[model samples]
Target: MNRPTLTRVLVANRGEIACRVMRTAKAMGMTTVAVHSTIDRDARHSREADIRVDLGGSKASESYLNIDKIIAAALSSGAQAIHPGYGFLSENAGFARAIEQAGLIFLGPPASAIDAMGSKSAAKALMETAGVPLVPGYHGEAQDADTFRAAAERIGYPVLLKATAGGGGKGMKVVERESELAEALASAQREAQSSFGDSRMLVEKYVLQPRHVEIQVFADQHGHCLYLNERDCSIQRRHQKVVEEAPAPGLTPALRQAMGESAVRAAQAIGYVGAGTVEFLLDARGEFFFMEMNTRLQVEHPVTEAITGLDLVAWQIRVAQGEPLPLTQAQVPLNGHAIEVRLYAEDPDNEFLPATGTLALYRESNPGPGKRVDSGVAEGDSVSPFYDPMLGKLIAWGEDREQARLRLLSMLDEFAVGGVRTNLAFLRRIIGHPAFAKAELDTGFIPRHQAELLPPPTPLPEAFWQQAAQAWVRTQPDQGLWTSGNGLRLGLPAETVLHLRSRDQHQVVHALAATDGQGIRQGETVYVRWEGEVHGVSLFDPIAQADASHTTQGGLTAPMNGSIVRVMVQAGQSVEAGTALVVLEAMKMEHSIRAPAAGVVKGVTCQEGEMVSEGSVLVEME
Candidate 1:
């Protein structure tokens, strides 16, 4: 077969994955084109591309998921290929066919291969023919709630409801009891319809204490396939992977071989090409079952690349060009351990609800040697609620698992994002947890250590106050009636006291100016290193700020950034404490806003389908 020339490739997606793909393609000397939504014209990925085309819509359906827009962008840019960097349209078999029909190379698997693995029901049946072990479940044609509920009963309690066409943990729910079956089924179906355009579902016997291990498989058109070891994605929240590492810890060599060979067999049966992942659920008995196959590069692919010293995206391009696999299965090396954690815009104290705001302060960890940060947004960019809330990924590699874990923790400490809530602290707690340090792995790792992971309020040290005071003192004019007299009672010439705010709490501390070291300045804030720890302090006008930390009981407000999906009560309606009032949907998940106390609804401030900011009042009660 003649190799296809990929002079230029259009990335038909947005955010970090697009940035990730562009980095490798540019390094390989290929022209890259980025197709962005209406709101993403100023995005980092668009600016990083050799050429960028506007997709002309803010939402996914009208832009990223629109096959015609992406195709037109590629053709207009004179690109010969399209790289659907995971998420939006990466796994869509129809999009792959459209690319092929346009005589353009799709830098992914063939449409046939995607079709074979797209649907859970069909994929499970196909795996049976391929002699691959699968989890016990009902992957039949019946799509009614009654049928699914009955199937769950047959599978016993704790059945998992999953969207047949869903990935990235969307449209998936765990029904722990019969009473929870109906609501879970409806929610899963609604999410499936919203996300995948298909509401068909499948029921599975939920495995207990299972480790999520997935094999990275690569294939070429000329009949070659290989597995690049395995990644342990067991540490998860809301069914989405949080921490991923290569060469799953505690896996015996024999078990690794068994899983890898099984993954290869599964790929061969589908005539797979390019990069793909076969996920599995492994139990305590060393038994494994096929979960699902992601027919595109995974979000956690960097960990696999870090361990193998190979670029999977480059391989995808080469394979799409009809080239042969670079190496055989025997040559695949798992040199060292690597770990990656997703950095999301979320509030851990508020149930990890997604947060969106202007990144007023953002500074990434410095990358050198084994530390890598793949991001799509820089400081001053807006994190909109229209897409995924992930800021980026932080990955670190070391000689061993412990080294990698410790190195990643240090790197995370160096990372900072402000003007919005983030899960950075939560990630630190997880990696530093005792069980995590001991390599005690399972799917329920997060919930198992939830108590230890939540932050307990601790008072700021005196050095932190000194750090803030130094920065604030420098910003102030030397001699002024208002500024010079901003101290405590009976204060002498040398007496200095500063009132400040840290993480939304008011602080009054005594801090004298220190003429020691320099502090790093970010925006209007200063980050100072004290006692071997970095502390960030920003000056705020006392008159402009309202102290709401103590008085949080006036009206029900939006807990995070989201749109009002539903309003359960009306104005003048009577409601008791804990009564549900409104539903907010953010990051593709729904959360109810309930009444704080028994009262009459004075008014409903927010209506359905309206976007609300964090802390925006939604309902007022009296």
Candidate 2:
């Protein structure tokens, strides 16, 4: 086979991954083309590309996932290849075939390799045949409710249901008993269909106290394959990785070699080409079970690159041009420690539900050696409800694990965002926790330390209020006695009594001329950065509060912009305090609205399949 001359490439995805790929492609002297949905026309990725193609829709299904449109864009833009950056259609075999059939290179593994590992059930069977150890479970063809129930019983209590065609924890659920199997299965199936266009599922025994460790594998058409060390993605929430680090801590040389060899074998068995990841669940006894293979560059691939000082994206492009592997397994380098944490527009206090709003204020930590920020949004950019809520990622590298961890913490502190709720403070607390510093890690890390990590909300500190008031006063245009409400009297000291509101709490802070604090005033709200946390402070107006319309005592509103997927309760339905009333799908995940207290449903304001905005009333109860 002759090597294809690549001069231009098209990125058939959006967000940070798109930008990340374009950066490398451009550095290699290739003109980069970027495709975007209607909502992402002004997105950071779209603006950075050498050429842009508008796919003309807001939703992923209508734009990013539309195979025909993407192929047409690549051809029209004269791109020699298409890079599906890790999600959307990255793992779709048909997309790969389309690119090949269109006479354009697909910068990923072959279609056959994707097919072999596309379905969880099929992948498990292939691994079994390859003599790789697997967890005990049912990966059969049957998909009926009775079959799943029986399989759950056979697998014993506590089983995990996973979408056959899913990754990134999109269509996954854990059933602790027979009673939860049906609903969990239904929900998981719906998510799978919405996400991957496939609802086939597989059931397996849910492993407890397991560490999610995955090996990075690279291959070429020349039959050369190598493993680029491993990453421990044990810190997670909602089955999705929150933190990942390269060269898992406490892993012996023997264990690392064994796992790396197995991963390489798995890739070679399927004739995988380009960048891929083979995931495993490591138990306390040094035993590991095969999980699944991600057939494209992983979100955490930066950590691998940090340790090896190799660009995996560059390797993918080189492999697509019929080149040999850059390095052999024996030559793979394992340098220093590297850690990455995902920064998302989400509310950690609210079950980590995705938040959508403009990036009113956005600032990244100062860039230097060992510190990198991969992001696709900038200040004034709006994060819509149609896609993933990840704003970007923060990565740090150092000569040792402690150094790396501490650098990542400093990066997190310097990072700041506003206009939408985020998990910035939540991430800081996690990394600063003594347990995490001691290298205690597992898939259940978040839940296990929920008491410390997800503690109940407390009142704002007095110092914060003082800082807020000071910042507010400094931003005021006038300080004159007549123009400013500084309570200036002819004979007494001047002081300003400001009624401020932060979230649901109100405080009257007196401001005597104190030094100003760091803050930004957007409209009537002052976003103050105090003690490494951002607090939004607004002036409280009693008149407006009295005139505002109020909802019923038990009204349940949509948490964010989303489509109602299911309405579990109807008018006049009496429900317990925790009964689910509605389920909203946003950012490719579902969030349920439950009854706040035991009450009777007075009305169902929103019907199934209705689009709603944040704070839109969904269910009214009495």
Candidate 3:
């Protein structure tokens, strides 16, 4: 049968994944159409496309996840194919079926395969029947409190409650004891419903000291399928992967071949085409259990491409156009090592909370040979609260593991972000850890090194204060007379006072100059190098709070820009320390605001389902 050509493609996604797919599609000479939300009209991915379609909403449900809007955009843009890039509607079987029924190419596995593995419970049951090794768990169809509780009891304590249709760690909770099971299950189900529209959960025994390994499998319509090695995604936080590396550090030839073959068998059994990842939990005894399979291209696919020199996006498009597999399993090349880190716009010090602000100073690492930076936002762009907080990805490839590791570390150092808190420094620590260097990996990697990874807060040094003073001087025309051309102050010591802030700490220091000799200004920020270290400080303009309506002397305020999902306590309610008062959700993660002390709630100012600003008072305590 002759297949229709796919020359024009519409990417039905947003952010870095959209940009990544567009790059490959454009390189393949296909016209790329980008569908964007109202908030992302000027985003990097929107600008990367040949033609843009406005989805006309700020939220994911109103825009990207709306199958009708995506289909209409593809049809109106004169595109012949649609690529669902990794999230949102990528794993939605109904969306895939709609695209195919509309006479457009769906650049992924068939809707049948998507349905086969769409839910954790369904997928596990199917995998068990296929003779694939599965972790001991309950994949029952009944979705009730009593049923789940009984299942958890049978599975034993310390089980994991995972949303049946979850990805990216949204609907995952670990219940260490019997008492924690109820809250964990409820939160997991709520998050699962909010994110994936499925609240049904599956309970599984939590594995100890297990490495999260996944095999990259590709298949074509002509009965050709092969595995593209594997990736180690053991380093994770909050059930989401933070770092990934290709050719898992210490896999024996026999074990590697077995896993790869098993992944291929799994894909073939479902007639899966395009890119997919078969995840497995590797234990300390070298035993493995099948985890849920992701039927879409993974966020960490770049490492697989870097090591194999294969563009999985291009492969997806080609396979959708009825092309045969580009290479056989024997012909697949496994070259040098590659490592990737997901840089998120989040405050790791603040319990890994998502941060929202403009990218006042977003500088990406230079993408030299074997170095790649895939990002969706540029400098001056706003990091909104409507979506995931992942800012971009940094990937590096080198001749050896050490070379890759060292190069990645240098690239991370060069990558800078401003105007918002990020996990940049924390990522550096993970890569620099001695255990990481020696390839000691597991799901507990981050928790084991929490003290080293999350260092105690230290006060800013004198140099930081000095730099702030110098920056303040340069910004003031009247103060310029006090400093020399070389950034040194000719005036007396403590001639000026500097009010500076870092993260949330405000400091007042009396200093004269930013430096003793030299300094440079970039935009509103000034950089000073002293004592063999360079410090960059931005002039802080504190808002004059005339009314203070958003703040209370003794009140709990909203910690971020999010909606109040729940109010656990009401007005005049007595609460003890650590008692949850309100629950706030932002970027798909839930944060509970607890009572600061044993006190009576004077009033409840916020209500459930209402959007609140960062500093709006939620409840007052007296």
Candidate 4:
């Protein structure tokens, strides 16, 4: 078949994936067009593109997820093809169909293929018909609580409820018993509806101690399909993958071939084209069962690329242009071990709630042969609450798993982000854990080792105080012997008392006139990096300290910036501690604001549908 004239391509997404795809497309000599929401007008992806289209909305529903807007952007930009870089509308069958109807190439599977596997329930049914082993559960079209309750009871306790229309742990919940079934189902459905515009759900048996292993499959229009080995994405939090490694650690050659072939068969069943991932729940005793199929490039694709030395994005483009598979199944290469960790702007200590703020100080790890940092934001960029909290990804490749793991640790240590809290330290602890080093991985890895990985905050050491003092001293105007402001006397070096504050802790450090330490001063705050950790230290001010000391003893506040989706408390209602008072939706996830102590609700400061900022009191108790 003659190659389709594909000189221009438009990316129908934003953030790291958009930047990632545009880089590959530009490298392939194609003009790249970027579509962005109003808030992302100056985003990295928009700036890097050869052409830009403004979709004109901050929320995804009005921009990225709007099929009409994306298609219009592609048409106006005169792009020949549209690449739906995963998330948003990547797996939406309607989006694929719209692109096809608009006379443009969709750099993904056929619309029919996506429609077949878009719904987890439908995908499982198709997998069963293809003779792929499945975990026993109910995947029928039933949204009622009673149906799910019955299914859970029949499938035994501990079931996983998932959104049929999407992945990414957005609409997924694990119910441990029958009593938790109704609430879990309702919450899962709400998240599903908000994310995919579909409230349909499926209940499946929660596999005990199962490893999440997935195979990357690729195909062209000519019916040639092959699996590009597997990745173990077992290290997860909240059902979202945290760490992923290529070529699952303990799989034998025979087992690898078996899973790979099964994944290929599953893909062929739907006439899948372009890139897709077939996920499975692998248990001890070599048993693996199909979980679902993601009909788009996965977030963890970098690990597969690292091990295979293949640019999956470039392949997606070529395949979309009607080319055949680049290599046969036997010719596929698996060279070395590779690992990837997601860098999310979230506070792990606060139940991993997403954080939003300015990127006061952003520094990526030094580029090298084996290290790669794929990020979308730069220093001074704002991390808004309107999108995913992930800032970027850190990927490392090495000759062995240990080398790859250590390299990733070093990379995480070198990485630093300020203003917004992040999971960088948590990721480092996970990678550096002895259990992870031994490859004792599973879906429960984070929860199992939570004590060590999520340890309580320790008091800042004296060395850190000294460093802060030195950093502060460098900011002084005068540095001469006679005019210095370092408590300078006639001859003796006098101690300068420096009052500093970090978070809620106040410190008083005394230091002599000395040189600066490793720190970056941003505004009134100084960020000091010590032993792989970044500490934000601010000079103590009486007024600011007094303002911070104002107590909210009986107030329940929003933990992050989001819209209030539900208010479960009234002004005069009484509640107990831990009672869910309000549900705030942010970054596509819901966070419940619970009552701090048993008391009567004195006031409901926030109403449903109101947008609130972090620390905004939602409910006042008395």
lDDT for position 561 in model 3: 92
Candidate 2: what lDDT?
Answer: 0.90
lDDT of 1 by residue, 1-622 (tens): 8565778999998889999999999998899999999999999999899999999977677788889988988989999999998877788899999999998999999888888898888889998877788888899998888898888888798899999888878889988998878867877887776566778899999988899999999999899999999999999998989999998999999999999999999999988999999999999999999988989999999999999999999999988888899899999988889999999988777777888888867888877789999998998899887788898999999999999998998898888777777888888888888899899999989888877887555677766776677666655544243254455545554436667766665577665544443466665666554432345667656766655324435688888777787788999899999887997777666677888789999888898889888788899889
Model 2, position 420, has a per-residue lDDT of: 88
Model 3: colliding residue pairs:
470-514
lDDT by residue (tens digit), candidate 4, 1-622: 7467689999998999999999999899999999999999999899999999999988888888899988988899899999999889888999888899999999999989988998898998988887788999999976788888888899998888889997888989999988778767878888888888888999888887899999999999899999999999999888888899998999999999999999999999888999999999999889899999999999999999999999999999888888898899999999999999999999987889999999888999999989999888888888988888999999999999999998999899889888889898899999999999999988888888999999887888898899888876675545454235554377767667878988777788987666656677788888887655677888887777678777787777888899888888898998898888898889988787887778899999988989899999888889
Question: Which residue pairs of candidate 4 clash?
Answer: none
TM-score per model over all chains: 0.92, 0.97, 0.93, 0.97
133-208, model 3: which lDDT tens digit per residue? 8998898888787887888888898898898888999889988887777777888888887777778899999887
What are the lDDT figures for the candidates, one per model?
Answer: 0.85, 0.90, 0.85, 0.89
Candidate achieving higher TM-score, 1 or 2: 2
Q: Which candidate wins on lDDT?
A: 2
Ranking by lDDT: 2, 4, 3, 1
